[model samples]
Target: MTLIRSLAAALLLACALPASADIFKCTDPISGKVTYTNTKIGEKGCTLLSKDQNVSAVPANGAKKPAASPTDFPKVDNSTQRARDNDRRKILETELASEERALESAKKELAEQESMRSGGERNFSRVQERVKPFQDQVELHERNVEAIRAEIAKLR
Candidate 1:
């Protein structure tokens, strides 16, 4: 059953590749596991699966060169581009300031929740459950602040 599966795999692999490849079936002497490959093995257990004459071609480098910009492409004026960059920086700075304020508010709210004690929440797990939402809110705001600061930094 395993030999049939190995032969099926070899046939599928041979079909997938170009007809030039000479498929080989090899069996491990120690493990008795059957394997198939295109490359010829020096071991005694390897046998040629395909009898047709093999003529393999080495493929050339496939990396593509970048295309040149067309002559008719729209060009932005330096002053206009500078104005756009300045507007973007101002927007990002405003967002960063807003996020910082939210982060501070979240921290304060989290602190308030942490300071409050409840008679019903006697267990430590109950206390943790009560504070979890506040903690999540604080974490979310902190992440937002960091992301906003990163965006502001990228403007430079």
Candidate 2:
């Protein structure tokens, strides 16, 4: 008797709730623009779409899987791939070495500039003026070194 009463109460509650209608999409014929709303579209030549039926559910992972690579994609043989990797590594190493040398030179230049005052004026501006070029050079070389290192890291 209690189960029968529970079923009757559930049915009454379901009937009492308001029904939510599907979305309606209306498009402008000339401009090819679309508008979506839950209310029925009064415009002629509009499309009526069911939100629950048309929308696809995403997987539990919360990301769509990537499409597989095409079979006709160009591929190099193992020996050719190895040679390409070797060439890339060698180029990156050479650039890294060059950047290292430049960095050392920049540091030395900055140090030399720091050790001397260019003029008799004891103003802060004078000191800044003398040090700015060396500071800029050091910063440039530092950036170059970091970039070369990053490129080397990317090499296979």
Candidate 3:
């Protein structure tokens, strides 16, 4: 009889509670990106945000358009603009060439490090640490070269 009464009381308490959905927060281990969803739980990097709380979604407002330029705004002539563009292109090209040379130097240094066999460094981690800076330099220069080329291409 007591067990039946306890079950009835539990049921009543459950019914009295407000119905609120659960929110889960998930984070990517590699990218460190965070995402929130309603249905994920107990998975890797997924944690229950709140069981009793409710989250509301609101649409973002549209972007405001830019105001028109003033009538007295100064404008460059076509030939002047063209000359400026040519100068910009030349600068970008020079930067791209420099970056390419730096990248090649980094690659050569990394190759030399890899080829050298150090008797004291048997561990793979130590080798990786030694080569990491060279690798990073190569990657940085490569990205810079790519960006300079892109800017040059965008020139009129």
Candidate 4:
């Protein structure tokens, strides 16, 4: 309910509405809603009402235009969005490098655990940590790569 009023108010404000031009008499047709500029349906577009006529008048052009969608906005090339992706890629790469280092260290630790630790210690803990963090890094890198490719594709 509030959304409808907000849309109406936005249209009125866009048209520089009068205080009295606040009523709307709308009816639905097979094609769509036929919005009247005044109480009468003769006007084609938004027709200004005199003060007396406008006291209880429904605003014309207060309805949002049909076919108004986000896609109607201007388009941009992949290079523009690619810049953002590149920034993200740099960060992802840095994280991936750190993860790789950690993973390598973990693998070595697990290997040494077989020789250095009590026989009861299986050394599986280090390797378990290895799999999760490295897997996460690989997934992050894969997603970043896919996003960069998509941005490039958009430019073509």
| Cα lDDT computed for each candidate against the true fold | 0.79, 0.77, 0.80, 0.56
Pick by TM-score: 3 or 4, better one: 3
In order of appearance, the predictions have TM-scores of 0.56, 0.54, 0.58, 0.30
Native-vs-model 1 lDDT? Answer: 0.79
> Judged by lDDT, which candidate is best?
3
Candidate 2: the clashing residue pairs are none
Model 2: per-residue Cα lDDT over 1-156, one tens digit each: 346879986786566645465667888777877877566656684777875443323354677467688999998899999999999889888888988898899999899888887568488788789889999988998988887787777766
TM-score, prediction 2: 0.54
**In model 3, which residue pairs have backbone atoms overlapping below 3 Å?**
none
> What's the ranking of the predictions by TM-score, best on top?
3, 1, 2, 4
**How many pairs of residues collide in each model?**
0, 0, 0, 3
Ranking by lDDT: 3, 1, 2, 4
What lDDT tens digits, residue by residue, belong to model 3 across residues 33-78?
Answer: 8887777834699998888565543223654356699999999999
lDDT by residue (tens digit), candidate 1, 25-94: 8998888988776777666889998865464432336553575989999989989998998999998788
- Record all residue pairs in model 4 with backbone atoms less than 3 Å apart, i.e. clashing: 23-57, 23-58, 24-58
